[model samples]
Target chain A: MKLRIYALAYLLFLYAPIILLPLFAFNDATIIAFPLAGFTTEWFSELTQNKALHEAVKNSLFIALMTAIFSTLLGICAARAGAMANFPGKRGIIGFVMLPLVLPEIIVAVSLLVILRQVLGVNLSNWTIIAAHVLICTPFCIAILNGAFQNLDPSMEEAALDLGESRWSAFRLVTLPLVMPGIISSMLIAFTISLDEFIIAFFLTGTNPTMPVYIWGLLRFPASLPVVMALGTLLVALSIILLTLAEILRRRGIKRAGGTDKGGFL
Target chain B: MGLLSAPFTYAILLLAVPLLAIVLFSFWTQDFMDVNTTFTMDNYREIAEKPIYFSLLQRSLYVSICVTIVTVVLAFPVAYFVSFKVHPSRKSLWLFLITIPFWTSYLIRVFLWKVILGYNGVINSGLINLGIIEEPLTFILYNVNAVIITLAHAFAPFAILPIFVALEKIDRSLLEASQDLGESKLMTFLRVTLPLSMPGLVAAVLIVFIPTIGDYVTPELMGGAGGKLIANMIQVQFLQLNNAPLGAAIAIVAMLSVTAISLLFVFLNRRWLRGRS
Candidate 1:
């Protein structure tokens, strides 16, 4: 019973700053402080008028979309192999690939920056950022899809194979259909991670910065703080909607498969 | 062979090669506008001599450790509540609520921490109005405390998942059996539940600690002048100082330290388990 109160307080501590983002965003004053002056959507209106912000948003969307597709595609291959195979060095390889999940983003960003620019002499662009985002996102996708594949009945795919279907065809026809929901959720979550990511974008973005980088640029000016808050409120809303959608899809997928629902990445 | 083809190539080229490049780069020195390919130890020597590097690394580890402990300790109860108390049918809902804030922009979250901790920020103003305190607290923002608070908050969800999974994996009958054997609830928890959850606790600690140490952004944004960590210095070395080799060396050092500490933690957990039974 006492733990219940502790849980609520823990959540409040976890949520306090986030709760503050919307407050100051709507508060009708430049100074973000106590005593609500009035309610206004002025800052949000300001968000629509900024040309650079619009461009940043466009850049972020493209990068995120590419990252989602590529990472999820890679994730399907990896997670499928993980669930289906018993190869030597399997655990080592999976752990190696998943290292990016825990590797410091700073390290990832800087190392990739060095390798792309210094070693490969590849110019920094949206593609560069996408490459980095994919590296990070693949691990997450694999983690999610791993659960999905594990919950699957491998015998269905086996039956397909025994009926003269090739291995690829068996997976394509049977296993793929079963895991489509996981694929969608994986893509959505990957899209969110890439879109919200900052440090990698900070280092890897070319002339056109991503939205987070643009927000970082805005931090230099004190006047634009409200605009940032408004922008943040929207980003938060968008992510929540995406995540909620993903979770629902994942749950529905589990139900459709007649499996008791386990937890998802949500 | 087919399954390993695409991702293995992608991971190797993208993840493996770049990490190798950093290590190779660290062996050389940087000359103005050019990277000298000649192998040298100057960067490591500089790291050894410079007090700031040590201090920053010390602070990064200290900050990372604090964030890990706080996040894991605080998260355990929430994880436990959801796993042990909540109805299984609603477990996903609770997990969803827990993870929603995590899905929000991490950059924005850290920036907001500045706002909440900044002078005339949320807490200060809220407190001043509530008559809880006369003066605003100056110590929270642009300092180590702020960094810890922000990182801990960001990593809370990460810490919770593993611990919750661990707690769920425990056999309920064991707890019942312990209680049946005349053990109090507290004794059963300490002897049975806590020991069983160590794997999750260790994973949570590493999950929180590794990235927090490498995180320079929070320290950069919320850490003010005095709050820079090792990652900040690594950033400074590569970007501001034009010394990629030095930055590479520091990163390599930081990475080694993390790996060593993580292994030490696993080792300690094993010994503790051995001692217990």
Candidate 2:
């Protein structure tokens, strides 16, 4: 009974700030204080009319979409290779790839910034940020897709090849379709990570900022706080939806492949 | 064969190249519009000579340790409950719910805490309305405590997941055997469960500690003047001071220390496990 209550309190502590996000977002007060000042949808409407915020959102979407596609593509190759091939230094290579998972984003950002600006003389742009995002997000994608690939039976591909299918055609038909759910899961997870990413985008972006960078800029303006809260509410909703979808797809992939569910990112 | 290794090659170039560049930059000096490629130890010297850098590094380490300890201690009960007390059918559901907050924007999460703990924010206003306090608490918002609280909250899910995974992997028969031996439930848990979950606990500690030490966002958002961390200093060096070399030096120093501490942790954990066995 005591442990149960402690767990409940812990959940509350984890969730209270998030609950506060939507609560005050809908509250009709500019000042983010107490005494509920009636419910309002003005903040949500304000989100639509802001031209700069719209541009920022567009940039973020473009970056996230591109990041998802690139990272998931890389992940598919890596995960497939990891599952099928036995190479010298394979574990070392995979570990190196996943190092960015725990490496400080600020460090990655700063290092990339120096290389792009100083050594390479490349202009900072959306492409640069996408590169950095892909670097970080690929590891997550590989992790998700690795499970999918590992669960697959190598005999299926072998049988397809033996039945007079070309290797490419066999992979396209057999392996690709089998791992489709994992691919989708990887894309969604990568998209979410890229979308919410701030530091790398902040450092590497040129003029156009991602949504989080824009939000960080808005934080300095005291009047903009309510709108940021409203934006936060929307982002929170979007993230929960996307992440849930990703987790569901990941679980379904495991089940479909007849694999026991080891733990996933969720 | 080449196709399979394409992504690995890309990873090496993208991840490793930038890291190598940082290492090179740390050893070189920056002259306006021209980087001196000649290697020098001045960057390291600057770091060694500067007392402020050393103090900030110490403070960052201290804060990170506090956050790690608090997060791990808080997470254990939740993980224990989910692992042991919860019904099997509902365990995944509970875990899914726990991770929902993790998917929320990290920046906004930290910012939300600012609003919740600010002088005129939620807690103070709610308390004032209830006539619980006449004056708002000023200390709750801008100190190291605020940084610790916000960070611990941020990292709770990270701590919980690993520990939960560890707890879930424990052999149930061990618990049964301990109980069969007439051990108390708590004693059985301490003997069979706690020691066995050390790997996950160590992983959780490292994950929370390393990231929190280098976290600039939380310190910038919730940590007022007094609560700045080493990452903030690194940020200033790169952005404001126009000293990439210095920033790279500081980053290298920070990374080396983190690596050293992590190694020490793993070594000590191994020793402890060996001693117990």
Q: Give the winner by DockQ.
A: 1
Clashing pairs in 2: none
Error of 2 at B39 (Å): 1.9
Model 2 chain A worst lDDT run, 10 consecutive residues: A257-266
lDDT of 2 by residue, B1-277 (tens): 4545767777777778888999999999979857788989999998999898898888888898899999999999999999999988678778888877876888889998988899988889888889999999888898888999999998898899899999999999999999999999999988899999998899899888887767898889888998898999999988888889889999999988888898999899899889989
Pairs clashing within candidate 1: none
Q: What's the distance in Å from true for residue A247, model 1?
A: 0.5
lDDT of 1 at B263: 90
Docking class of 2: medium
Query: What digit string (tens of lDDT, one per residue) describes model 2 on residues A115-172?
Result: 8888899998889999999999998899899888899999999999999999999999
By TM-score, how accurate is candidate 1?
Answer: 0.97
Off by over 4 Å in 1: A162-166
Residue A21 CA displacement from its true place in model 2, Å: 1.2
Cα miss at B251, model 1 (Å)? Answer: 0.9
| Best candidate, TM-score | 1
